[model samples]
Target: MKNTYKVNNPATGEFISEIEMNTKEEINLALKKGHNAFRKWSQVNAHERSDLLKKWMDNIQAHKAEIAELMTRENGKPIKESLGEVDYASSYIAWYAEEAKRTYGRTIPSHNESKRIVVTKQPVGLVAAITPWNFPAAMMTRKAAPALAAGCTFIVKPAEDTPLTTIRLIELAHEVGIPVDAIQYVIGEGKEIGEIFTNSEFVRKITFTGSTPVGKTLLKNSSDTIKHVTMELGGHAPLIIAEDADLDFAVSQTIASKFRNAGQTCVCANRILVHENVMDEFANKLTTEVTKLKVGNGLEEGVDIGPIINEKGYTKIIAQVNDAISKGAEVLVGNEYNANHQINTYFVYPTVLKNVQLDMKITQEETFGPVAPLISFKELEEAIEIANSTPYGLAAYFFTNNYKTGIFLHERLNFGIVGWNDGAPSAAHVPFGGMKESGLGREGGTEGIEPYLETKYLSIGDL
Candidate 1:
């Protein structure tokens, strides 16, 4: 018998609908079809591929309202944020469409007379993309757009909680002239589908955005075939407020960044480090700004923070907060949920904790919810030390008006992406990834298509 997965609304704790999971045989068939499609897709020129992507973008824009509602219902993000994500996702598709025609190659003069050398880029092959539930549509397009632009056939296994959005995405692809076999969507146990992706010889590359532990497992599995993998994994991003920073501006940006998407983002301010001289002022201003946010069902207008993804997420946040409290940290606003509340009622108040210790679990781990743990530092050196202490370094935010200090932090920070004055720094043209245990490879900018393309060198000599 085939397995099935059910969906739920975290805000109301209501069951949505059940969907059937693909079987092992179905996965294998999808792989075969994807491989077959690659043979044809790789033959299409870059301009034609660019044209197809433009149509896909138009489809997304035409259905933005429906897409945003579906995403809000499935992922529990505010409708406003959902619509914003749709715009973000479409921008990537449009970017890669233009980038496809600009895949440059070089011709070099051979050392030996009468010999010519040329290097060219081509699609790597079949690609498997595994995306998480947090930003289902955006992550899907982020990976899919590049792969398609590079002339590769691809398959997507979206998180079970948010498969509907991906299903709709594949529908748009087909409607916009993407070959049926060139893009496939399968929903099932991740282990079964992941094993096929990692072990299959036909699968040449895999891109996954999820936890570091799972990324390690996929890396280990892919080692057998030596397949190329791009892993955008876990992050414990830190935000630093220098003593010289504008207090009100820093506090407001912190609130916006920390609570966006209910802090489920990998790059959200997991640990906020404030200079000792301004710590008290920063904390007070941050608390006041956070309280202004309305937390409720995502469909309601002015609901800034939606419910936690599910019961597990709510429990995890509660446990992290309790652990910190036991270690002597104090709550500033948004206290823990009551113990009597049903597990199905999965909303955690948007929380901000003060007097946080670096050793506390909430500070060390990725608090994947709307909780900001503030830690104070006396000097710039101390602030940098505390920010770089964590093994994860995906992104960091620093607020400062001092030019020298801004350059110092920008250069010294170990993260892949850094925002000097801007709290929200994500862009389609900028490269994004992580350092240390955060993940591997980059996903955007001019180099975005590098993972999907393989280079070849050719030489000829004439008599």
Candidate 2:
């Protein structure tokens, strides 16, 4: 049966769109198409692929407003954040477009002058790029843009909750003459879609962004056939505020990092560790700012944030909040859902929590909500220890004016990406990914495409 999946409006728990699921035969057909396309597509010159990426960026720009709105509709992020995600995603196209031509090959001198050695990078054939719902379009493009830039044919399966925007992106690419199945999209539940991608012999690479447990599962599956896998998994990020940190800046940034997208981000600051010297001021300022954030429907103007994605995410967030309270955590600003308060009928309150313990359910696990736990530390050593305590080593943020402390923390933190004396926008030109459970493989700049490609060595016997 060709079952359909519906995208639900989180605030109202109403269906937004119904997407058709590809059947087993259809999945096989897509794999066949990808296999056929990869041979021809990967054989094309790098410059040609770069040119198409440029065109794709332009196409995305042309439909920026519509695409961003659809993202907001599906994921319930503020329109501004959605638009920012689109702009950021466009930059990925531009980045990989330039990277495609700049770093492709190498030549190593042999022991004898008569012999020469050459090493060149080649695409990994068909890649199945699976993306998560939060920052849906950007995640897909981050995975697909690099694979395509590396000359690989892609079958993109975006999260079921937010596939419309990305499906349209594939359609846009087709409009720009990238070919019909060169970048196909499968819109269905993870189980069905992933089975096809992992089990198919023709699909050689799997590029994914999602939870760590799921990443582990996929990694195991890919290993069964020895297929290449690039996974961007979950993170429980920690933000530390040193004793000398600017309390105002620390508070504002903490709220922003923790609650952005209603706290659905995998890299969101899950723990806030503040030195005891600044705890009172930090907590006060943070709660004040969190209190002022205008949480409403994404389509409305001036709304700083929006609802959690789907009723399941919404319920999960509420459950975490209630559990936090029952376990001795106190609400600083928001603790209840204002269900009667949706404009497009999709909205949630920005939440803040204090007096949270390290063993609390919300503290240990990812609540993926607007909840921010205000934790206190007495010493720099303790702060660093607490930050690295979590198994996830994705991204960690720290605020400190002391240069020595900043340098020490930067070197000591276990996270893959570290933000110095501030929150997690390290840079766009730099690489992004984690070290441990967070994920494997980079996602930006020159390093992004390295995961989607392989290098081959050739030697000339008698030059």
Candidate 3:
């Protein structure tokens, strides 16, 4: 089977390219190159590696506008939004450039007068980085940046839908003196390509960002060989509103957070659990906010929201909307799909559903769209109950004025990352992974370097 796939622009239903798939034979060849490259790449000093990475950074910024256009064309995200992704990605390259210099060795306390103990971090080997379509630049950087900084080579297989930008990036890295085979690109069915990584002995570490069920499967695959794996998987994140919260701020934040990228974000708000005291007020404000949102081509100016990723996302969002409506949830703003100029473009209206209950699929499932289902809670305990009711534990947000309430939920949210009185995620300096089925390990902050490296201990005795 070939790893060939076609990329489409959902906003305008445009065809980008039909990528030639990598065969198993090609995968083996890449693996061989990755292994050979790893030995040579990892042997270089930290300063040399940092300088090489700096070249890649300069190249990325030099082609920022073009790269963002490629991203938008492939992923259906707004051009400006895609630019934001590239900007964030550049920061990661810059971060890793500095990190390469800071990867340190440690000295252990001596147990005997004539004995010395030492510990050091070394790159494991070739890293297999599998990234998803949502936030392609960020997810790619999260894995590739740190791994490269730790002196590891990479075999990056970006999601089939949005592989052009990634392929361009890998090519650019090669152009800047990073060995061609040091970073390989393969685009295709995620499962087919993933097996090539997990079953191969040459791939020393695996970093994946995608769905939960898929993450578990990857975890199981890597477990048989005990290959190092770091997963940044899916989430059905909840946004909680307390009675004492600022209704205006909470509504604005939720709309922005959830509707960003048309609500395809793994950390995007899916379920809205508002306190009973201000449910009506919040709903009214949310309706006005959502109704006023500009929905058009991603490349168009003043477009607040864009189309979903692809046909599968279109079908999923349609099904979820239909199910919610049939179950008595009222649509307050936009409903159904919007086609442009008689062509059934992938544009979905920013949907708002009220009278939602915990039993509905919209609340239980991750509605990867611009639909916000409203759930009311009579008390703080009830809000917490609804928030933790899902199977995911990726990211959750709560708006509350009471310090006690914020602290209480902060400790009991059953989530890996939480935001208080805010909608954006934690800084890139924090450990960014989730509990339960969300993912396997941390990606950023100080904890990120450990996964890319293996610790070695040295003990010296009297000679």
Please give the CA lDDT of all the candidate structures: 0.90, 0.83, 0.85
Tens-digit lDDT track of model 2 for 5-76: 777765555568888888778888998999999988988888999999999999999999999888887887
1 against 2, candidate with superior TM-score: 1
Please estimate how well model 3 matches the true structure, expressed as its whole-model Cα lDDT: 0.85
* lDDT of the structure predicted as candidate 2: 0.83
In the range 1-463, model 1's lDDT, one tens digit per residue, is 7788788776776677799999888998999999989989999999999999999999999999999998898888999999999999999999999999988889998898889999999999999989999999989999999999999999999998888888988899899899999989999878788998999888999899999999999999999998889999999998999989999989888887899999999999999999988989988998988888998889999999888887778788988999999999989998756332463657778888999997799988898999999998888888888889888989999999999999999999999989888889998888999999889999988878899999999998893
Report clash pairs, candidate 3: 3-21, 4-21
**After best superposition, candidate 3 residue 276: deviation in angstroms?**
0.5
Kindly list the per-residue Cα lDDT of model 3 for residues 83-152, writing each as its tens digit.
Answer: 9888788777777888888888899989798999999999999999899988777788778878888999
User: Alpha carbon lDDT of residue 164, candidate 2?
Assistant: 89
Instruction: Give lDDT: candidate 1, residue 396.
Output: 97
TM-scores of the candidates are: 0.98, 0.96, 0.96
In candidate 1, stretches whose alpha carbon ends up further than 4 angstroms from where it belongs are 338-343
Which consecutive 10 residues in model 3 have the weakest lDDT in total? Answer: 336-345
Worst 10 residues of 2 by lDDT: 339-348
